[model samples]
Target chain A: MTAAGNHQASRSGRRLERAGIRDVAAAAGVSITTVSDALNGKGRLPDATRRHVREVANRLGYRPSAAARTLRTGRSGLIGLTVTTYGEEPFTFTEFAYFAEMARAATSAALARGYALVILPASSRHDVWSNVALDGTVVIDPSDHDPVVADLVRQGIPVVSDGRPAGNLPVHAWVDNDHEQAVLGILDHLADSGARRIGLLTGTSTDTYTRLSTTAYLNWCERVGQEPVYEAYPAHDPCAGAVAADRLLARPDRPDAVYGLFDPNGTDLLAAARRYGLRVPEDLLLVCCSERAAYATTEPPISTLSLKPGRIGTAVVQLLIDAIEGVGAGRPVAQVMPTDLIVRASSQRRSTRTTVSPPRSPEND
Target chain B: MTAAGNHQASRSGRRLERAGIRDVAAAAGVSITTVSDALNGKGRLPDATRRHVREVANRLGYRPSAAARTLRTGRSGLIGLTVTTYGEEPFTFTEFAYFAEMARAATSAALARGYALVILPASSRHDVWSNVALDGTVVIDPSDHDPVVADLVRQGIPVVSDGRPAGNLPVHAWVDNDHEQAVLGILDHLADSGARRIGLLTGTSTDTYTRLSTTAYLNWCERVGQEPVYEAYPAHDPCAGAVAADRLLARPDRPDAVYGLFDPNGTDLLAAARRYGLRVPEDLLLVCCSERAAYATTEPPISTLSLKPGRIGTAVVQLLIDAIEGVGAGRPVAQVMPTDLIVRASSQRRSTRTTVSPPRSPEND
Candidate 1:
């Protein structure tokens, strides 16, 4: 262990009461300003003097109070990550692969910049929101009239959202995939693979992701002169997804290809196809938006529309931190990240194609 | 919007500057103490008076300073959740099914009690740890001599871990599955299914979970007079798990059955089995520990040993909160949670099995 580690251990063991900054100043025979400047890397000081003050502080177990620091600096070095839900239950960030991956990347990015992410709920009690001093916030999917976002923005706190804001909601910045372009690309890919008609398994929620993807699907169906055939479910409910998949497949005029908007839709549709004895790619093509690595190893390897949540998460944190630190302060920045379509056996019709594209490396995503 | 929501929306829209408590008290025509008491549901205040004060404060968009409140009450509603990493990179809580599910449950449990979770790295810089005032902390897997846990404990902060502390490390409370019993049960289950030999895929890290599970496996092998055949790798790396799985199957003394200790091992092992032209449950029986729902929908529906992370997460948070609020002060508490084995097609022998156990409902866990 380093000397700092050893000093910390010894101090933790021997010290019965917390040490204050005054003790460090007195023991080191240095003024309070010198100690403060040395510890905070503020005013100029000699390297030897700074090291001597730090060593004395560490030896004395002198630690600053977070409350005092926050009050003094008007900064907490904390960023809020709001999990938005469309139902009564608060959104658990791990419910979907997209959220899980996004949160992981966000945490990494925040830590890289010496900030920590606090998990907050969009619909939590007002006290829950106000109990922590956050420099900025990253809301997953703000509602059309999300009161929490409105409140944060009103307080002049920089708020960056993972999904595009709905209605006239205000956010300092946002990072989101091109939902319309991604959906259109998937529909075209399915069509190119000999899909006569493509249906959609979408969410009933009005979040920007769901609403935009569903609208894109409908617009594409209209432009291509095919009637829209789709089923909507409460995406938060896992069983509802399976039941909705069954309903989509059970339709008398069931489309030959299906695109799902949520993470678990691919498996739900696969199970539903099994129930109806519909072979994938042969009878129906399947695709869904997911960040789960398990999909790559699934039987027949289901095709997935990768939202590149890691990139989005990293970008959101960078924007939020930039806003918090007064970098790029004027105009709110909205970045549109590209999506990846991981083509797999589930989406390819083996019997119809004369030329086949080689499998793309998963690392490209 | 309700009256409260409408007031908040209006206040946020019109207020150019933040409202102080003094302003709220003056506007409400009440003493500062009276306003505070009414807003906090304290003191001898009538229901009508309390309602009036809160309404006035809401209308004025008066939010108490978190730093001030924290200093005055000597408490912060923020709870720290430390994510420990064994490799160089910081642990991403969503990397595995166990962590993802555990964190989800922990977040829900904390929110239920009006607390929010803050994600912190176990190896984060000291300033990061001191930047937030946390009422308590929940360490996922503390090292044998984790300096962070020691420092937090020394500061009179209550810490509850999700895994048993190795060596003589101190923690306020801990919640962990009975690893020895769980591993023995799985090995015996495999034996009962007419397996001649069973191999193991485990991690090289010495965390309590891995240490206890691996020790149990070795002890079980010694008792049965069978040489232990296992492959150990750094579990944090996904590609390492795949390579390790392939190596285990390529061994000259490869066991007829294998149990993997990580979430991704099931799919990795299955893929390796295919390379060897082996059929699941016929050529090799396979099982892995996981909390993922995808395992049930795999090619042959892989069996899994579930650590019941949700239960452990809830239990850990409950214990930490109890310690923080002095629910059961003094004696530290240790909880042993139960594990569930979800038997699926991959772990069952088709031809050798004379009798079959009915499928257990997943909700029983």
Candidate 2:
């Protein structure tokens, strides 16, 4: 008897009604071994035979049970991405340009490695977490001693984080931009652009990014013998940002140059500057941390601190997949990437025209 | 003997090493029935007991096996969201404001219903598809005869689409905007604004939205006895949009007004109009279909046709989850929703300024 017949005899009493591997072999006129090899790309076979077997299986609507496959391989090929939410809805986290860009790159990187990325809220219900079998997880901006991160670590699931974990949160690996260094560089750039005092538009969030950047700004101010001038607001609330920007400009001790720590701050600051009758690069210099392309086309295109979210996204996934596959089985891995300073017309005292300007058009501000 | 003793006696041989309900029962000094009731939110259980049981379970790092649960309950609590990609990466599809808003609403809606939404590329490989056990799926703008949709339907998976299915493709349910009516309304609005000649900026894709809108534009032109003048480009290609916008303006018989069918068309057409020294409203009226808030703050605040993507997203998920739960068992559901026309300065020849303007800023144009 052939191997196909033996296989059929063994499982016929249990699952004969469903379209099994035996059914595919019989339909394609191939042995069970040949069918298995063709489906899995295991053994060397003719291209035509493999295609034929796949087509036959597809026609029969033969699907390998995900649950059964999990039992056999012990891998679900799923990576959970925990997004830090600022509002009740988890999707509000992606409203920022930085988060959106980072997520896109991470999704692309994960897909290229044959794993599907699942977006799970950081504050997801226990049942939601228990329903999906994740090979590992990637946490973005984990809070200090996050319960979710702690639970996952205790469960032995490898976790890679986009932002450096605050406090003593245990993470398998982490990829983050050098936030302190990036902030200092931006402050220096504004100082060199002939600004008397430099100010900061920052967030009240306690996440590592906001905290680190604010600290760096304060340190820079102290080192330069200048008092820090800044306004802080709840970044997640859309209306609060504009009010804070207006308040900053309304201050009696307003700084000549300002840097915003969030994405929408560029526009908010620009509108504020207009209300004060201050032209960019003349009375006010503007810069913001963002990955939005719209800033490149703004009136007097705004200077921006590019966190290079794409690189961070790719690095986090690579480190995560490596930890999952046990490529580097040692201590935790930490990667800190450099930031890019995109100089534009808004940040310069004199129009050097260093960057390529758009097509000649009437400037409307 | 008590129920807890019987349960422990029956399962002690197989899973004594692992933390089980018996472990929780013994630790909390409760019956096994009480532990199960507290954990599942079933039966009359005090809130304190439920919280205590949950804390113990969390501390023990005990997770219900997703595979075993699937076998027992036959539901995974997972919903697949198939995003139609315009490029190689699935993330590019979310670059549009309409899509981003729609997805956000869908994610919010799914989470509210106790289901975690998974972002799956519409062109996902077979392995990716078969690796997750999804109770239902939400397909966004399914192509005519989409193999993925067909395969899912064959496997008895419920699929609810955001757009109407092309051809005779079988779908469990669908929700779509009134695209033809939306187009006709926008054309009439432009004509009413004293536009002698109006043109359209459309896409070359054969999807239902593009096809319906384009056909409606053509029919409107015929009704007005004006020769059709429009530019069609591959909407997925980012750079192609700007080139097409410029091409439309450079024509000898240039249009006095134009309506774009995509999101970025507002910015692209504005730049093109500037290059020709054509002022908005005075020379060339502009409008585009978008859900972007940035358009509200543009120099001449461009008019926009809002497809109300949030409503559509919520409706699609509601229909899908309803079908998944076997609620309202009947024929397939089809919902057509209305669109909103936001008339801004760019669409009006003589600015009546009916809408409340932003805090007056210096206009350089």
Candidate 3:
């Protein structure tokens, strides 16, 4: 066996002559054994010598083959972010904005703690759970009994979610806004304003956030003993909300107040109100759940339940980093941050509007 | 030296006991010589034996160790993206959106050709060009006489830039929108509208896009024989644009039309117009360059010059993939696509008379 190993080393050495241990040793002014010892962390070499050898190897543009490294470490810094098909929903600008914000936040946080975030588009061609060389994964919008989540857990990769779904495998950690309480708060605010009939506009039922918001709205209506009038759009774009608003408002029994589950949905509802000649508040009230920058500048500034997505993003990063460091593990953990309701012109009734004060000229304001 | 090397190897083996030639031989059910011969493509071996040996080693997760593998491969599939900082500019959102789109496109293209994109944020802590493990990098918004670009070239790592600075370099490939022509087109449209004095709302001077737009605005102003009244904002946010518009419009000789370099700038300008009691188009015409979704939903929809950012992203990916596949070398390539102007209400001034259509009764369009 020893003689056979010597023959194997000779053949391997010849094949790797251009980029072999000898070249690295020569570059670092160290023996081949020293270089080998430094890389594998063995053989009682001085710390400085090991550091010097490693630095020189890196400087010389050396990379251990991934296949070989995987065999040893059983891990890779890469973390896959599995997003549902852009084709399923056409990747709207709003989704793009949220993802961008989340990606930047996640990347910075990951790097600070020594990890890399690699986005992997969820495609049927590759197994979401098995193909990529990743240490862990963060999944967004898991469905009821999502196969992706199941397969990933079965493969033993740590999984964190943006929101929880009806899944058997215990979720490692999750960060989400308290949508139910947020909806109840909005409803209570509207009820206080003497809105007898309130209408609800929401995104597709597929998203967990939308479903949660809908459930909360229905519960609030039941508690208040009021008939629930609502519309769920097939998509999340502003156009969908606008069209839904038109249909809802065209009815003889129009809603006195409208609540949108998201920013685009809220913005669209406002546009539709203008088209229908319904003066905000006095004629029809409007409120949305997201405090996106665009909402703050729209015509009659929208009243929104500030979800503070940036804050949520920061929290998600902190949690992921903690998990990566092996600080938190075992059993599921879910975090819910408080939401703030921002009251603006859209929900302020004209009669209750203390002063018309020439719509605070955009320039002056 | 050979005896010393053997002694050190033996000592290292005793210290670590990590998988190496001996382990691969054991797993492969072959002599160590056969395993090495198969891996190196040196000594002749039967195809079936080589396949079986490789499969068994893979199953056993036997890594030759970094030192052993680094001695055989000189390249790493890591690519770097050098950005100054993630969130320093409001452009982060815009930049991130573009980058994500570009990344997705590049990933698909790179995989087809075999490469991976690794992002490395540019920081002041150290010269990133000197430290990252990368085959090549994509530099964004190069400053005039950037040393980083020079360092990358000296190191022989290929670079592709989104916007190359004025100073010359042996750039591998570049991709940029034709801002000069795009701005010129917007100016031509404004000139046709019979506007003599036009005000420009430009974004921060740090961006290459802003610099290009400013130069185009000045040149167009000179050619049309109109005063180039302009204000430069500190950032690209809508609030900055609004503040700039206020300063420009508040002057006794307020310009008739405001041309913003992008959508947020235009949105702010329109908002300022409302605040200043100046009706859009009638009192102050407005036009912007980006076709961001905000334009379609504004109270008075702002006209926009829509550039296909997604297409540009796709094009960049295609070019990078081609270069990686050895399609071209030592050849600097650049490509630009056309921009389309979508006219809307903000710039429409057929008549100034405020038509008081009956308050859109809840039933009207």
Candidate 4:
């Protein structure tokens, strides 16, 4: 053997000499097999003996090897939540809220099914498959050409995404809010409310939901035989929305209504309009595609397409648990929960009262 | 042996057979000694052989027994992050952002020093100490009688907290934001802005930071011989701020300025004030604690006390890493990063040419 091999063997011998099963057994005054049985909670040792053995083991700082136990049980009982690096900000408030909700839901689900949920932020440098200790992973922010999903698939790790990526991974499953239909519904509501010309304030172009919402807006404008005006801004910073709104509203033929792709953007647009002395739904109508907290308390509470974040969180957790429990990989499931158009003063053009839109049907989407 | 004892012995034997050194050796095409060396990454084996062994072992789902590994190595490369369940919603957003930032920093720090961070949600049902295989934990939202810290201490698990908990644990190291100074700074700015009567809008009374800020506001008001008109709302929900503002502003002797504990409350108050036709600063001045995303885009741009979240995140990670690396013990250490009050139109009196208050030493607090 090489000198390195000799050194390693000597180190192992020293480690064993420092603290071994024999040491634990000697300290407990029990046989090695008896100590093992007590440590594993396997045999029905006398209560006093079991207690004594445990106390001694604790005092001695003995810890069983996780690898050995996992191999023997065929289960790690560990669930991982993998979030990607979107920008300098590791995760947004919306993403954080979603993750917390999902983590709580998954934790409860894991407990019921006998497991633990570990929130793991997948690094840009490491492949998702490297997190092999996880029984399964709940992937968030799936891009069109996600390398993480590809690696996970290669290593046969079950993955469920918070949003649907454009990849054709057969064994993949995802849960998402229907942005296409939601945007269309918002546009329809604006048209029904007598908005002659409507402007769209969009989020970052790279996001799937933003792209999808933009497509739906263009399609709806075409169907209604109306010209669509829009301004795109990065979603990460709300300040970008204000800048976009300023540019869009400065035109000679400014829109009578503004539809924001998300809650923050919608709120920012409204704030911008207020700065410019334009009144909501009178001088300019406002609508947003998300139901985040800010939309509810704005001066003239901005109209929102309410996506049920908690419900989506719950569904994702259930799907992940199902997959981990050997439920046939979930059939490339794409479950889209519908969005509710909550009309508040910002988009309420009509003098008469109107009914709030019903909750979206999850099954239909 | 008794029949039950015999049965348990047979089951344990089968478990041992499934996860023995022989199994790993066979999977890796190496002798038991070579397999052990590769698993430990200490012996001189061909790099390809070591890589193949690790891959095959992972594929075969090898999990080294924690008991065995701990006894041999005297260490477990696990660090924990403990968060309370009370402020799950708002705290989730704040904590998740902080956690993600901390985790990223911690991951690099821990990996360099040889460790892993494991997130643990505070729970009464399951003992975090028993459930987690961690060398240490970073505690958050510490309560007077935090069970997680208590249990971990009883079990002798090293711990650090983001905030001070009620009980003084012997080995607990903690880091906290200087809320007292932050609140005083914002209030002082409001006072300098020609505001005679200042109102305070605080987060939920339950939060330690909210309580700290409220006390500071009351104390500062008492010292200045001014009546502090204040209202406390639940958590960080902007809707709560809107509701509270309705009552506070509707009063006959309404305060000239409102100082919010944080951005959401401040932004909400601004929105509500707009609904009441009270122009900011000219009519009712405003200032807030944290400069979150919403503050920059609000109408008349809300002035905010900017707490460096990224710096705080970096500090928390460094502290936790220090403890994990055995550089410190269970002692309370509070590190307060400086705060900057960014003056804007919301808090600026139109008559005054000086928008910014003169910079003051943060050490004054």
Chain A TM-score, prediction 3: 0.78
Clash count per candidate:
0, 0, 4, 22
Show the colliding residue pairs in model 2: none
Q: State in Å the error of residue A140, model 3.
A: 1.3
TM-score of chain A of each: 0.87, 0.85, 0.78, 0.75
Which runs of model 2 end up more than 4 angstroms from their true locations? A1-18, A21-61, A352-365, B1-61, B225-227, B328-330, B349-365
For model 3, residues B265-329, the per-residue Cα lDDT tens digits are: 77678767866878777777789876466676676777887666556645665665566556776
RMSD (Cα, Å) of candidate 2?
Answer: 5.2
Question: On a 0 to 1 DockQ scale, where is model 2?
Answer: 0.46
* Model number with the top TM-score: 1
lDDT of each: 0.85, 0.83, 0.66, 0.66
Candidate 4 i-RMS: 6.3
lDDT of 3 at A297: 68
Q: What digit string (tens of lDDT, one per residue) describes model 2 on residues B1-365?
A: 76657756777678444476667776666877887788888999889999998888767656777776675676877889898766676646325556666766777788788888877888777678888888889998888899999988877889999899998778999999999999999898888888888999999988889999999999999999988889999988888999999999999999999999998899899889888888887889999998766676676778888888888989999999999999959469999999888888788765443432222221110
True contacts kept of 3: 0.09
lDDT of 4 by residue, B166-212 (tens): 55654456667788898888788878888899998876656677778
Residue B351, candidate 2: Cα error in Å is 4.6
Question: Against the true structure, what is each candidate's TM-score?
Answer: 0.88, 0.86, 0.78, 0.75
lDDT string for model 1 (B268-360, tens) is: 998888888787877899989987777887878888888888898889999999999999764789999889888887888765563334545
Candidate achieving the largest lDDT: 1
Which pairs in model 3 have colliding backbones? Answer: A19-B71, A277-B360, A361-B275, A362-B275
Candidate 4, residue B304: Cα displacement in angstroms equals 2.8
